[model samples]
Target: MQLGTFSFVTKLAGFEYTKFVRYDDEGDLRVIKAENAGPHGFKTTNYSRVRSSSVAELTRSRLHGGELLMVFVGAGTGNVATVPEGKDFFLGPNIGMMRVETDTVSPRFVELFLRSSVGKALATAAMKAVAQPSLSMGTIRQIPVLLPPAEEQQEILRLVEQALTAAAECGADVREQQSSADILRQSILAAAFRGELA
Candidate 1:
């Protein structure tokens, strides 16, 4: 079955920020926008909040957790993230949320594919070539997905996780090296000021 075939996939409707959005410091529902969804994952620390009352009107936008979020509009278009379970997040403008109803197809697997080079190319090709490139829900549904065996899919996910963990560690190492270099430069500057270098 294709993505939009309702039998296996459920596409959540996104609400326009200007029309239904009312940011409240006390709001319990956080809006996950394009910026919130990135390569690494959804950034939970900082995001706009909408009143629960406003969200009650648009129940479809409320994330049920495990939904694959895709940014469909603007420069950050095609960015994807998996909504963490137990988080109260609402779909913001320029983004779309999709939920896989069947346990046979893992949402994470779909997310990984969507972030892959092949998936990105497919999405890019499907996008409307306007000044602001965008992918409609219809276009998204039309995009083909290859289904590997369940065991194979699991193996692929495990490998991706391992690679991501290594990448994160490497990033940390780079940052540490940069910090050490900065400290060494400062120490050298301080020694020069004190006339320690003969």
Candidate 2:
């Protein structure tokens, strides 16, 4: 099915009001700020826990797997990330999650599309100028997306995964080479200081 066949949210996901309950005796929930939120989808090796006294605090939008979380209204506006395996995280108010209908569209394909330059362009244009440039739900919903057949979508996803795997290996090799260069430089410096090389 095509992307246009799916329904779009009139408002940004997680903009609704909800109740929050404090989880801890200490006021740790109040200290849980948006700064602790990480950029969606950029797989990083490290993550810091968001301290909160309350487990039921409704500060951000709840997210599920197979959803696209876009930074709509923040310093990271226009940045897009897909939810990885499981669900059980909240998105800061600055972020908006796009839940595509799995029946109509392929989530994996849509994610790869959003990560493309064309998708970035659309998101960039949708951003509104404010204290911090933000994107309105209406603007995001209006962004045109091209959808292909389901079979085509699956093939595309397979190709993308293969490409990403190769890219990651190349990046690792580059990092190893850089580390080797650094070690050689350190050895030369130590030898020169010790008068081992005349």
- Using lDDT as the measure, which candidate wins? 1
- After superposition, the stretches of candidate 1 with alpha carbons farther than 4 Å from their true spots are 6-19
Cα lDDT, all candidates: 0.77, 0.58
List, residue by residue over 149-194, the lDDT tens digit for candidate 2.
Answer: 8888888889989998999999999999999999999999999999
Cand. 2 Cα-lDDT: 0.58
Candidate 1 lDDT over 78-108, as tens digits, reads 8888898987788777778877777677788
* Model 1 / residue 28 / CA error / Å: 1.5
Specify the poorest-scoring 10-residue window by lDDT in model 2: 28-37
lDDT of 1: 0.77
Candidate 2 Cα RMSD (Å): 4.8
RMSD of each: 2.5, 4.8
Clashing pairs in 2: 23-53, 23-54, 24-53, 29-53
